[model samples]
Target: MKHVLVTGGAGFIGSHLADELLAQGYRVRVLDTLAAQVHGDGTRRPAYLHPNVELQVGDVCDKEAVVRALQGIDAVFHFAAAVGVGQSMYEIAHYTRTNNLGTAVLLEALIASPVAKLVVASSMSLYGEGLYRDGSGGVHGNCERTLAQLERDEWELRGADGGLLTPLPTPETKAPALASIYALGKYDQERMALITGRAYRMPTVALRFFNAYGPRQALSNPYTGLLAIFASRLLNDSPPRIFEDGLQQRDFVSVYDVVRCCRLALESPAADGEVFNVGSGQPLTVRDIALRLAQVMGKPHIEPEITQKYRVGDIRHCYADITKARKRLGFEPRVKLDDGMAELAAWLKDQAAVDRVAQASAELSARGLTV
Candidate 1:
C-alpha cells in the first residue's frame, strides 16, 4: 500500500482526510504539533484521530521534522498552519512565519525527499467580498467593504449613486482580494507549493476550502470557522452571536465532502498544477445557518442575537462556484446541509466544548478588531 504523509493530520480536516486515506488502503502518517489552541491545553494526541494513523508530533516549519515525515511517503498533504483571519491581523509576524515560512521549509525538505503528489490546503478568505453585480447588469465582483462604509453600518456593497450590488458565485478565475494577514499567508502558501512543486517536477494541487465544519472542530480557535464557534455557544446554552445583521453569506461545506475532494486531488492526474474551490455549492446566510444548527441541537429558544456588529476585514458575502472542482476532480458535495447539521449536533451532545467565544470576543474588542 502507498503511504501518505498528512501535515496537521491531527486537526479537524486533516484528521478526517487521514481516516479517508486509511480506509482507501493507504498507510497514513500524521505529522502535527497538536497546537494548544485547537486541541486543548495539553500537548497530547487527539482522541478523535484514528489510532491507525502513525502519529509524529512535529512542526512543518522544522526542516528535520518535515524531512523525517517525508520518508517513505508517496504523497503529501500540507495542511499545517495557524488558522484565523481576525487574529492574524494583529499576529502579523506569527501568521507570516507559520503559514509562509512553514511552507517554504516544507518545500525545501521536499527537494531532498521528493513526493509523487503534493496537495496544499488553501482558504476562501482570499476572495474577500466575492463577486457582485450592479444595477446596470454589470458584474463588479471582488470588492471589499471600506472601513468608512462599515462605520456607517453600510454592510452591503454599493455601486455608483449608492446602487445596491448583489452577490455572485466566485469561481477559481476570480482575482484574489487578500483582506487579512491570514488570507495573504494562505495565498502565499498556495503559490509557493505550486511554484516549487512544478519546478521540482512534483505534481501539485491547491484546494481553496471555504468554511469547513463537522466533528472535531476546535471551539477554542475563534479566529476561523464560524460554525464551530456557533456550535460551542449553543452547546453552552448561550446565544449564537450573529454579526452584521446576520445577512452576510458564506459557503459551509462538510468536512466529509472536503476529505473526498482532497482524496480526489491526491489520486487524480488532472488535478496536478491546478487550484480548485472546495465548498458546498449552496450558499446560506449566517443567521439562517446558526438558526438551523440551533434547531438541530433542540435549542430553538437559544436564538442567535443579531448583534449588527461586524469584525473588521469581514466580507459581505463569499461562496464558491465549484464547476472547476466538479469538472477536474469529480468533486461534488454529497452531505446535505440538514444532515451535516444533525451530525454535528449529535456529535457535540456528549462532548464538553468550552465556550471560549466570550474571551475571544473580548480579545478582539481590546484589539479594535470588533466594532
Candidate 2:
C-alpha cells in the first residue's frame, strides 16, 4: 500500500481527507497537534485511531518531527496552518510561526525524504482586491466589462490607440499579492513549496480551497465560517446573527469536494506545479445559506437577524473560477448546499447524544467515580 503523510489530520478538513485516504487502501500516517477542540467537552480527539492509521501528536514546525514522520512516505499532503483571518490579526506571531516556519520545515524535511509528490493547502485570499489583468499584460479596473463596454466605460484601461483590452482571470500566471498577514504567510508557504519542487523536480500542487464545511466541525470554534455557527444557533433555537448586510457571497464548497480534489491531485500527473481553485462554481450569500440550513432543519420560517458588528477585513464578495480545476482535475461538486446542510443537521443531531455522554462523564469524574 502507498504510504501517505498528512499534516493537520486532526482538523475538520484534514480528518475527512484522512478517512478517505484510508478507505482507498492507503497507509495513512497523520501528524497533528490536535489544538482545535472538536467535542463539546473541549478535549482533543485523535483523528485516526484505527489499526491502519499511524497517529503522531507533534508540531510540523519541528524539523525532527516532520522528518521522522516523512520516513517511508510516498507523498505528503501539507494541510497544517493557522486558519482564521481575524484570529491571525490578533495573534500575529503565532500565526506567522505556525504557518510560515512550519511549512519551511516541512519543505526542508521533504527535500531529504523520498517523497515524490507534495500537495500544499493554499488559500484564495492571496488574490488581493480581485483585480484582473488583460491579455496584453495591462491591469483593468472593471474585468467583467465587455469590449463595447470597455470602449464606453470610463473604468477601462486604455491603450495608446484607445483599443479595448481583453480581461483574463486571476490565473496562476499572476504572482499572488497578499492582502493580510494570513494571506502573506500562506503565499509564502506556496512559494516555498513551488521553489522546492522546481529544485527537486518533484510534483507539487497548491490547492486554493474555498469555504469548505461539513460534519465533525467544532461548534466551539469561534473563527469558523458563518454557516456552522448559524446552524448551531438555529439547532439550539437561538437567533442566528449575520454580520454586515448578509449580501456578501462565498463559494461554499462541500468538504467531500475538497477531499476529491486532494485525491485527484495525488493521482493526476498533470496536476504538478499547478494551483487549482477547489470550490463549487455556485456562489451563495450568507442569507441564502442561513435560509437553506433553516429550511433543511425543519425551520423554514426562521430568518437570521442581521447584526451591525462586522468582521474586520471581511471581503464583500468572493468566489472561485473553478473551470480550470474541472478541466484539469476532472473535479465537480457532488453535493448541493441543501443536501449538505441536511447531512450536517443529521450529524449535529447525533452530536447531542455525544454531548449527553460527555456531560455524564464530567459529572462522574467530579464525584470521583470510575463510571
Candidate 3:
C-alpha cells in the first residue's frame, strides 16, 4: 500500500483530504500539532484514528518531527498553514512563520527523505488585482476579464445609473492580487514549493483553491470560512452575518471536489510542477450563498445581517478558470454550489454525531494513536 503523509490532517480541509486518501487504498499518515487554536476545546484530535491511519502529533516547522513522520512515506500532501485573509492580516508574523518558513522546513526534510511526490495547497490571492494597465499593473482590464466570465452568475455589472452592465467570469490566469498578509504568505509558499521542488527534481503540484467548504469545519472557530459559518448560523436559527454589501462574489467549491483534485495531483505525472485552479468555475454572491443555505435547510426566510465592517484587502469579486485543471488533471468538479450547500446543511444539522466522531478521534489520539 502507498504510504502518504498529510500535514495539518486534523483541520477542515486536511481532515477531509485524509478521508479521501484512505478511501483510495493509500495507507495514510497525518502530522499535526493539534494546536489549541485549531482544535478549539482540545477536543478535535488527529484525523487518522482508524487502524489504517498512522498519526503523528508534531509541528511541521520542527525538522525532527517532520523527518520522523515522513519516514516510509511515498508522497506528501502539505495542507498545514494559517489560512484566511482577514485572520492572517491580523496575525501576520504567525502566518509567515507557519506558512512560509514551515514549508521551507518540510521541503528541506523531504529533500533528505524518500518521498517522491508532493502536493501543496495554495490560494487564489496571489494574483494581484487583475487590472488592465499600460504595460503596468492596473485594475481596469484585469478586472474586466474576471467580470466577463462571471456574467451569468450572481454578480452582474451595473452601470453608474444602476443599469445592467456586461458581466464576466474570473479565469485562472488572472488571479486577484493578494490583498492581505495571509494571501501574500500563501502565494510565497507556492513559489517556494515550486522553486525548491525544481532544485530537488521532486514531483510537485500546487493547487490554488477557491473557497473550499464542507462538513468537518469548526463552527465555533470565528475564522472558519464563510460557507461553514453560514451553515452553522442558519442551523441554529441565528441570522448569518455579512461583512460587506453581500454583493461581493466568491467561487465556492465543495470539499469533496477539492480532495479529488489533490489526489489527482498526486497520481498524475502531468500535474507535477504545475498550478491548477480548483473551483466550480461558477461565481455566487454572498447574498445568494446565504439564501441558498436557507433554502437548502428548508428554513424560514432568514437573511444575513449586513455589517459595515469589511476586512482590509478583501476583494469585491473572485472566482476561477477551472479549464486548466480539467484539461490537464482530468478533474471536473462533481458538485454544484447548490448541491454542496445542501450537503453542508445536512452535516450541520447533525453536529451531535459529528461531535461524537471528533471526540472519539480525540480520545484515540490521547491514547497514543498519535505520537
Candidate 4:
C-alpha cells in the first residue's frame, strides 16, 4: 500500500509510526481528536507530528470524518481510544463509545470502502495477569487476585494451594481475563475488527502492545505510559508513586521497535489474520525501572514511593512472549532498555514535565476505584 491512514496518529506512538511510514516513501494520513486531556484544550496540531502527514481534526466515532479520512487510504491503523485502566472503570460509557463504538463505525466504513489491510491496536491489559508457573514448572494462565486479597496487602496471585504463582511470559494464547473497562474495550475492538474482517474477507491484524515508551509523549497525560508518569514525578521533585510493593514485572518496549513491528504487519502477508504480541521480550520490575530512570535522568536521590495501596484492576505481573511475532513477522526489538531510557531521558529534559498524578490518584480514590 502506498497510502495509509492512522487513526490517533497525532499521539505519541502513532506519530512515530507515521514518521516511519513517511521515511519508507509512503503517504500518511492521520485522523485524531485533540482531546483536551492530552492536548491541553488546544486546537493547534501537535508539533511532534510529522510535517508530511495529512492531519484530519476529527473523532474516530464520526462516520463522515472517518470516511473522509479513508478516501485515498490503502490501509488502516486504528490506534485512537480512551486509554487508561483506572479512569475507564468510572467513565464506562465514554470508554465504550470512544473505543468500542469507534471501532464499529470504522469497520462499517471499511465495509463500504474496503482497504487492502486493517490493523487494530489491542492491549496486553486484556490478559489481566500474565502466565504463571508452579514449582513443578507447570505453566498456567488461570490467575487472579481478589480485592480482599489486595486489601489485606497480599500483592501476589496464589494457586489453589495458596502458593505464590511465578510470573511467566504471556503468549497470545493466554485466555483473556479483562478486569477493567479499558481492557474490555481494547478486546472488543480487536474481536470486532477480526470478526468483521472474516465475515467480509478483509485482511486483518491485531497487535497486543506491552508497556511502550519513548519520545514525543505528553507527560501531562498521566495515563499513557508509566515511565512518563515516573519522569514527571521526578521532574517535579517528588518520588515516583509505585503501587503494590513496586515489585510488579512488565515488558517495556521502545516505540521505535513497536513502529517497526507495525510496519511488518502491514508489509508481510504472513501477518494477516493473526494476532501478535509487540514488546521487548525482557522483563523488569517496576522498582528496577523507577530506579534506572532516576539514575538515567540524573535524579538518583528521588527514590520511588511504594504505596501499599493497589487499584482494583491492577495486575501483579505481565510481560510479552514475542516468539509468535518473531517467527511470523520476522520482528526483533533492537533498542536496549538502557539505550531507550537514555534517549527518553534526553528528550524529556527538553520538554516541560509536570506532576498531576497525585491529584489524579485522589480522583480515582474518590471514585472508589482505588482501595
> For each predicted model, how many residue pairs clash, with residues at least 3 apart or on different chains?
1, 0, 17, 0
Question: How much lDDT does each candidate structure score?
Answer: 0.90, 0.73, 0.74, 0.92
Please give the lDDT score at residue 353 for candidate 3: 19
Q: Model 2 TM-score? A: 0.81
Query: TM-score of every model?
Result: 0.98, 0.81, 0.83, 0.99
User: Candidate 4, after superposition: displacement of residue 146 in Å?
Assistant: 1.9
Identify the superior model by TM-score, candidate 2 or candidate 3: 3
Q: Model 2, residue 339: displacement in angstroms?
A: 1.5
Q: What is the alpha-carbon lDDT for the whole of candidate 1?
A: 0.90
- In terms of TM-score, which candidate is stronger, 2 or 4? 4
The residue-level lDDT of candidate 3 at 347 comes to 76
Ranking by TM-score: 4, 1, 3, 2
Candidate 2 CA-lDDT value = 0.73
- Identify the candidate with maximal lDDT: 4
lDDT of 2 by residue, 258-307 (tens): 99889999889889998898888676878888888887777877888875
Query: What shift in Å separates residue 58 of candidate 1 from its native position after superposition?
Result: 0.8
Please list the Cα RMSD from the true structure of every candidate, rounded to 1 decimal place.
1.1, 9.7, 8.7, 0.9
Q: Report the candidate with higher TM-score, 1 versus 2.
A: 1
Error of 1 at 212 (Å): 0.9
* Residue runs of model 2 more than 4 Å from their true location after superposition: 36-44, 47-51, 131-177, 352-371
> Model 2: how far is 54 from its true place, Å?
1.4
